[model samples]
Target: MVSLREREAELANETQTLQTAADLFDASVSEAANLGQSSASVLVALQGRVDAAPLATAEASRLNLLQVAAAAQPVSIPTYQRASIDEKDLVDVGKAIDGVRLARESLPPLVTDVRDARSTVTAALTSFRGELSNLGSAIESEAAKAVTINDSASQSFRAAVTDAAARVKAAQQAGGDGLAEMPVYAASLDALRTENARILALEQAERDAAPTTPRNPGSGSNTGGGTNSGGGSNTGGGNQGGSPDTGTNPDPAPSQPAPDPDPEPVPDPTESEEPPIIIDPEPAPSGTVPGATS
Candidate 1:
């Protein structure tokens, strides 16, 4: 039979454990929800990319057409006079020359239209590139966030599992007739264990369900190597900002000059000098011959 004090202490410990487990579980749930939101955002961003793909293709076609037209050389004609015997012949010849002149005049507008189309396509291409870059960055950022959430959840779940296991072992050690004597304590412990198990399962599932890291489309490598002639170096550096070797001091910055050492303390000349002693003349007050040998 457990004493009241022992039972109370046990209940207190169990309650504390339950509280800890509840906190961990709540954190895990919050993290999971955040990850879900991030994933949804990524999906929406990707969908936008998909929708823009066709526009990019169409723009590319228009650009190519305009480029071909822009490269075309203009044709020139030499003026020629036709012999006319009557009014009918002159009118026919004039009509034919007018038709040729109209066609020649229309060519310039065609060229202008082609140039404008090319410019429009080029702008569209620039926009598409920006969209793709933004989408890629967003996806990578979301993936990193998801990874962080999962890692934190994993740690929390492991800690909860360890705590619950310890409590269950302590309970068994207390010898309480198979957990029936302390119903509330037993129930709390069981609840903690069950929650911990659920957390572990969720962690595993998340791990398994995680998407593979995306690679650059142009690069054949799975490690996201971009297509730069300067090897696999990231053109814009790492994710955060700055270069990859930001902290590494292989070469110190040239702007910062080396610090000078403290100057040696100069010995004070006055420290070595002796203090002058003042000779007080003997009090001539009472006296009469002050200039005497006193």
Candidate 2:
């Protein structure tokens, strides 16, 4: 018959093994962080352009993306910094191997803690990688989000352009009342032009990403990618493992129990990490609310 002491020994081993595995998990995360950083760089650049754009454009979808990005803060992924033995709550069954009653009562619980920690680490990696992928895809294809000026929209688009041009003209030939509305009207026209130019730029970028690929001999799409400012989330679990160590045993468990001779008792894990705060690229500073339909 397997002695309770031996079984408890097995549980202790499991705990240490899992803690070691958790330490290595960060290596896997570093690669994901690198990929996310690439996408983040591009996203930031586009955000800057949007910020400088005139508020008259009133692009709500873009603004919403901005808000989301702000909410999904902490885009930077960190590598493993922990080096010390992370067996804080991990029960050292070896210490209690001689205590049959204690081992029976405590060993199983230690295994539970070990398994949970590893699961937490695994889950965090999955979520972190997934978020990066989503954010990248959103940005690389974001140019598609602009309002399309197709046949249905052409009338409104032309009207806006005409109105803006007329306003600029009136402003230039300012008289009494005209002078009062001169600056306002002229500023509005400039905003309209900026919006128009943005539309054109997006179209150009789209064409660049996947240029018309001929079906015959040499084929190429020459595609261009884009970004949505709603920054990617790291709503994943926090980095697992303890502080850095020099291959030494971790400190004894802090919690008291007549169980482990050395290792400490683990408490129920409070798993979730902080939800990141996304940096939003706000609209232009001209205090212009979006009212025009461009």
Off by over 4 Å in 1: 1-91, 152-294
Residue 269 of model 2: what lDDT? Answer: 70
Give the poorly placed runs of model 2, Cα more than 4 Å off.
1-12, 20-43, 46-97, 100-107, 118-124, 143-294
Clashing pairs in 1: none
Q: List the global CA lDDT of all models.
A: 0.42, 0.39
Q: What tens digits encode model 2's per-residue C-alpha lDDT throughout 1-294?
A: 454446556655644554454444434344334433443433333343222232212233233333333333222121222223333333443333345444345545544554454454445444443433333333223222222322223345545444543443444344211223223333433454466777778878888897443343112221113222234422332112323323233343366767758868775578546667889876754756656443
* Model 1 agreement with the true structure over 96-151: per-residue lDDT tens digits: 55544444454455444444544444444344334434433333343333334434
Count the clashes in each prediction.
0, 23
